[model samples]
Target: MLIANYLLTCGILQANAASGMAVHDDCKLKFLELKAKRTYRYIIYKIEEKQKQVVVEKLGEPANGYEDFTASLPADECRYAVYDFDFVTEENCQKSRIFFIAWSPDTSRVRSKMIYASSKDRFKRELDGIQVELQATDPTEMGLDVFKSRVN
Candidate 1:
């Protein structure tokens, strides 16, 4: 009788485990669907704003056809590509500029370039340093000029 009871308990545990795995798979599928839907909506909005043209001009054009632009976008650690350009200012301050190309996964071939600027601080935290000088200078035209140069 004890052996029969043990076998029954083992079967019940296996069944429960299988059900739990099924539930986990279903939840994962739902999450991916929701995420894809959200990304699609965002792409549509960006297209309406003419952001696609801006991205294309910055990146020089996508290697793949425009129809596959969305599929070319990076996911997680798989970014499309990155380009970095560093320059020295008149005040002897060093700054790094980065451009990240993000593509869509749909038929629109929509793309965008995310730009970033950072001052290189070599001496940690010093008051009279290059980083401080860069912060004090106006950065209005720096980004625009850099972006325009990329298109050419």
Candidate 2:
């Protein structure tokens, strides 16, 4: 468990270079730890409007699984998450991939969607090791079937 005091200033999160939202350095640090060290199941992130920057919202325990990861995304908001995905390939070999998910539920506000959409690439670029990118606007869009399909 890390004692996080992360908050980004006006840096990343600008798709068109007209906005001020940014990603915290801790976000990239945590991602590196997850990518290189396998330290977390997933990391949830959100933009703190008051601060106008992206910040870490939650960290899944090392023992947590995919169900825990899917459940952690809110029903009516936008979020960014990184998940360590492990699977068995057709050749009976074990493999893992780092997935970056943009969870923007349909029920979320229009403004929220806009902000998340605009900032996604910048934030994604900050985390350099993500292997797969998934954008989910509904539950069915990101189900196990979808995950499996995208893995290959």
Candidate 3:
């Protein structure tokens, strides 16, 4: 009887650990969606783990003009606009930000990154491709910025 009780307790603990890992995994997926939507020209993503925020840094001084954008994400089943940025740059310059998600005890450290595209159309297309890739990915193969180029 004692052995049976010990086994049962271990099983319950394992189940709770599994639950926590699932929650963390979901958070990572949500963060990825947010990152893909934010990609644009003259910007890159720098993921920071310490603070739970995405920092949008300007790529030097804007030479020509600034373009504004609003990025939305689903949080708690309701859509929220997480970022509104007035992005400025020269013809081929760039910017970057780190999108941080809190650490979970059950899962390894996870974060998301956004890369700005030089061409608006190309950025949109890249984002679309990222969406497709996310849909088809399993947990083993998920990675950040796989389809994006780093700014020079």
Candidate 4:
């Protein structure tokens, strides 16, 4: 009876740990979605932990010229500048690919930037496509003049 109770308690603890991770991941994804919404129209279709990615299906065209819009922002307001570009997925011939310019939360300078896509295939495809451009950049690294020249 004691052994049974101990096993049951362990099971409950494990379940609680898993639940906590899920809740934490959900909150992070929701925060990213909110940040994306501030600059562009986005719909978060899925968030997968195993995949280690968030899949956002863009709802409509970007509100303003992508570069100009990001460039015009005040440094302290956003955590990351997210950009969406086009790509061809196997399931859907063409889809939007999202990337993030991770910022230092206080300074808002680019820490790094990366393709925040759904899967490996999409990430590879984006890299392969020569014409694909970064739709977002650090306002500090590339000023408005340089950012304008790089936009697609």
Among all candidates shown, the one with the greatest TM-score:
2
Clashes of 1: 3
> Cα deviation of 1 in candidate 3 (Å)?
28
- Ranked by TM-score from best down, the candidates are 2, 4, 3, 1
Q: Give the Cα RMSD of candidate 1.
A: 21.2
Superposition error at 44 for model 1 (Å)? 23
Off by over 4 Å in 3: 1-20, 24-28, 39-93, 101-152
- Note the clash tally of each candidate: 3, 0, 13, 0
Please give the lDDT score at residue 96 for candidate 1.
41
Query: Any idea what lDDT model 3 has?
Result: 0.26
Model 3, range 61-82, lDDT digits (tens) per residue? Answer: 2231222211112111111112
lDDT of 2 by residue, 21-91 (tens): 77888898888889888899899999887678899999998899889998999999999999998889999
> Model 4, range 73-99, lDDT digits (tens) per residue?
445433223445444555657655444
Ranking of all predicted structures according to lDDT, beginning with the best and ending with the worst = 2, 4, 1, 3
Candidate 1 residues 1-152, lDDT tens each? Answer: 45435534755222222211111232223223323332111111111122211111112132332234333333321122232334566677775433333322223221111111111121111112111111111223224454445433
**Judged by lDDT relative to the true structure, which candidate is superior, 1 or 2?**
2
Per-model RMSD to reference: 21.2, 8.4, 15.1, 13.3
